[model samples]
Target: MKASATIAVARCGERDVVIDQRCSAPFSVRQCDGRILLASSAAAPVGGDELELTVDVGAGALVSVGSVAASMVWPGVGGESSSMTTTCAVGDAAHLDLSLEPTISLARSRHRTTTLVRLGSDATCRVLEETVLGRRDEVSGRLDLSLRVERDGRPILHHDERFGPDVPGAWSSVSVGAGRHVVSAVLVGIDPGPPEVCVEADRSAAWLPVAADAAVAMAVGPDRPSTMNMLAALHPALVRTAPVSKPRA
Candidate 1:
């Protein structure tokens, strides 16, 4: 089955957040503490499914989006594949946070995902993407992931990666080393930072400046907990510590 979900949010006042419009099936959106939570419903997606999502953050609004649970990718019975695409727009002085859950690819399964973000000159945004190869002692199927962000119509960040059986040594390559999972995080409109690498207990993570005001972090680990710990260690450096304030009148 194929599925799609869309969500739009805007600031009503100094601290009021509102949902402009939403459309979804097999996925549901809930609002809590000015953040939007997405979850799969009874008609959750399975093999051969396609999902799409669009998010719009109005001027002066502050919004965060996250999933309730990890999405499981199962192999198609007849050799089909699944795909997901997301598009986001952030207005002037707005803030958008995308803290998506991990994607677990089962044996022989195939999945693809793409995300595009457009931001205003003064907008602030943070994004996270994670993928786990497979269950215990199993090799993952395949995955193609891409993310792009542009501000004022100029490209600010672009990342694309492919992993799976089709790619030679996809799992055991130098890139992954001893890690079975990978996580990436990006921060825009932040202060510049020097490139550096940090290692902890069989995990390796790196942070590099992508633009004058943007940076990207990548980590690889043997399992979810370690990889996530690496991500947590790098978050404070990329994300702003101060709260988002309303745009000036």
Candidate 2:
């Protein structure tokens, strides 16, 4: 199945409002608590499925986008790979934050995801992404990820990576090592100044400056929590809301 979604936000007086929104099955979008949320209506992006999302932020507007839950990829009947692409446009003086839950690639499944960001003069944005190899005690399937960012038609960053048992060089000591989860973040509005690198027994992280006002941070670890923790320490989000921990029974 194929699904497409679009969202447009514009600044009106003192507040930013959603001017337009279009949703399809398995891709539901809604506004809540002054932000936009993407929710899955059904099991989606199964092998052979294609999904696309587009976002536009009007000049001077400040907006944020997030997902409700993690996405799961399953094998398709024809064994073809599932793919998802996201395109975003930020207008002059506008700001956007795209932070979504992790995506899990199940055993025997194949998936690919790509994100492209275009910014006008003085526009800024923050994007966060997370991925998990597979469920606990199960082998992971093949997965590919790509990210591209441009400001005023000038390239700012272009990165790509592949993972899984089938991908050669992914398991080497110099590659992912014993990592099964990854987290990456990009900040395009502020200058991180310098580069920083950290390595531990189960994880490694790096913060690299890319442009005068942009930087990228990445981390890989044995699990999701460690990876996210590492990236959080390197490139802290402007506004982050952590999940509430349950009390012991």
Candidate 3:
């Protein structure tokens, strides 16, 4: 199956308003409490499925986006792989906050995700991605993720990562080591001051500046709570108030 969703928000006189919202099967969009919320109406991205979402913010507009629940990737028939792509564009002087819930990779499943962000001059944005290896007591499947950000037609960041039994060096000391959960985030138009690093027996996290007004943070831990805790310590504003809820059916 293939599906796509889109949303566009712009400043309307005195406040930000949704100018366009289109949803397809397995992808639902809603406006609530001054924020745009995304909800999956059906199981999706199973092996052989393709999905995509696009968000647009008009100049001078401020928009916040969140997900209603965590997404679970179920193994596709014959263990085929699936993919999802997210694209975001922020206009000059606009700000976009994308705080979606984590995605869980179930055993035998293979999934890939690509995120691309384009920013106009002076535009600001925050994007976060989190992953749980698998359900409790189960080995994780495979996941490949990539992120790219460009500001004013200039590239500022490009990152790629993969994890799972099939990924080379996924469990090596240079990677997550023995961790099962991972978090990655990027912030533009905000100076997080200086780099911060924290290392512990079972968990580690760091926030590093990548550009004049951009920063990236990464973390890994034995479990979800510990991993998110490490991220929250570095950028409290990016961490959600509540943890990602259990995966939907």
Report the number of clashing residue pairs per model.
Answer: 0, 0, 0
lDDT of each: 0.77, 0.83, 0.83
Query: What global local distance difference test value does model 2 have?
Result: 0.83
Ranking by TM-score: 2, 3, 1
How many residue pairs of model 2 clash at the backbone?
Answer: 0
TM-score of 1: 0.89
- Can you list the residue pairs that collide in candidate 3? none
Ten-residue segment with the worst summed lDDT in candidate 3?
A: 240-249
lDDT of model number 1: 0.77
lDDT of 2 at 177: 79
Which regions of candidate 1 fall more than 4 Å away from where they truly are?
A: 199-201, 238-249
Residue 108 C-alpha lDDT in model 2: 86
